[model samples]
Target: MASWAEVEADAPEFAAAVRRLLDAHRHKTLATLRRDGSPRISGTEAQFRDGELWFGGMWLSRKALDLRRDPRFALHSASVDPDDDDPAAWPGDAKLSGRVEEITDPARVSEVNKDAPPGPSHLFRADITEVVLTKVGSPADHLLIQWWREGKGLRVFKRT
Candidate 1:
């Protein structure tokens, strides 16, 4: 596993590229497993906070229900680069495998809500467990985790 130090001590260009992709996209399509073992997908507004993806919404929404049923979820953020818009153009995508937690603290909600673009509802946070750069074709497949220590590139905290 890559250490925090190694991921931090990465090439500036590569790091900036990753940040650009994450910042450019605000909407993520989250997938969860339904009670019957089916897949559910919904679009959500997300923010990168403290190196983790945070999302908020009405507690009664279908997406929220799915998360409540099964915390294991996947998020995908994607878009076309301004200069190109072809299938082969290879726009970047970030996939995160994590569990969702409903944060009920008004103070904490206010803090997270500040950075989130004005939206239609309340907010909750998700603590990312694993992330993959699908656009670059899975960094793990191309480079050893030990080679660059990709683990610490994005630090996430799970709710206790």
Candidate 2:
């Protein structure tokens, strides 16, 4: 697993591209495992802060509870339909998969979220296991995928 900073250090261009796609929108989809081993999809917001990827959940919200029980998660950036006339211009979408460690230290939480309300909440930092960015090819005839895995480093491939 690696921190966001570590990924950037290893692959600056790839990390920057992924960050751009992720930051282009506000809302994202998060997938977490339910107690029954089923999957739960929830709306979420995430951030790249202080060399780490961070996210939060409401006080004891289902998503929060799910993470507390099982740290594994997949976060997907919001996407818009590609223009039929110019699919090549699409900015594409990014997906991050990792395990999260709950941050329970009051001081650390305050530092990350200065505007944190006076109530219970959950703050998590990601230990990234994989990062993927998918988009249309320049000519719009194929798909481009750039990915980074914890041990495999970076890989780029195309699908026709």
Candidate 3:
């Protein structure tokens, strides 16, 4: 298999597509692995800033504890209307493969929250590993999405 950089280089547009989707969508359904090896999914809003994806939750939430033990997570987002026929085609929707890190520093967490308050907000910083954009082909393959990811940031990928 090729390296992460190699994969990202081969599909530059995919990365752009993911960024666009993120900008349009405000909510995401995060799927995490439980200690028992099962999967748990929950809906939450997200904010992307400073090259990281930030998510807030209650400290006692199951998703919070799940990420504490296992940071890996998958996110799914969908357009507000599946039948809409406007530009930005499917509106905002995507699947993201990433890992989460608990934001414990009061200042940093506060920064992540910004207008939103800290405490009761369990923040996680998602380092996007891979991103998939679905729905593009024919009706049979109406969900032909593209995926891309780099080991580092966009600047590094541009150099490589």
Best by lDDT: 2
**CA shift of 47, model 3, Å:** 0.9
What's model 2's lDDT at 61? 96
Write one digit per residue (lDDT tens) for candidate 3, span 72-139: 88888745665545423554367777788788898887767887754466888776676766654443
What's the distance in Å from true for residue 136, model 3? 2.1
Q: What is the lDDT of residue 90 in candidate 1?
A: 61
RMSD of each: 8.1, 0.8, 6.7
Clash number by candidate, in order? 3, 0, 0
TM-score per prediction, in order, is 0.63, 0.97, 0.73
Give me the runs in candidate 1 sitting further than 4 Å from their true place: 1-16, 81-89, 115-122, 136-160
Tens-digit lDDT track for model 1 on 1-160?
2221233345444444554666677777778788898998888877756544577666578887777777878777666653333333464565656678777687788777886445445565665555555342232223212112244454332221
The regions of model 3 sitting more than 4 angstroms off are 1-13, 84-88, 138-143, 151-160
Candidate 2 C-alpha error for residue 81, in Å: 0.6
The deviation in Å at residue 138 for candidate 2 is: 1.5
lDDT of each: 0.58, 0.93, 0.67
Candidates 1 and 3 compared: the better one by lDDT is: 3
Give the lDDT of residue 68 in candidate 1: 75
lDDT accuracy of residue 109 in candidate 2: 91
If the candidates were sorted by their lDDT against the true structure, best first, what order would they fall in?
2, 3, 1
Candidates sorted by TM-score, descending order?
A: 2, 3, 1
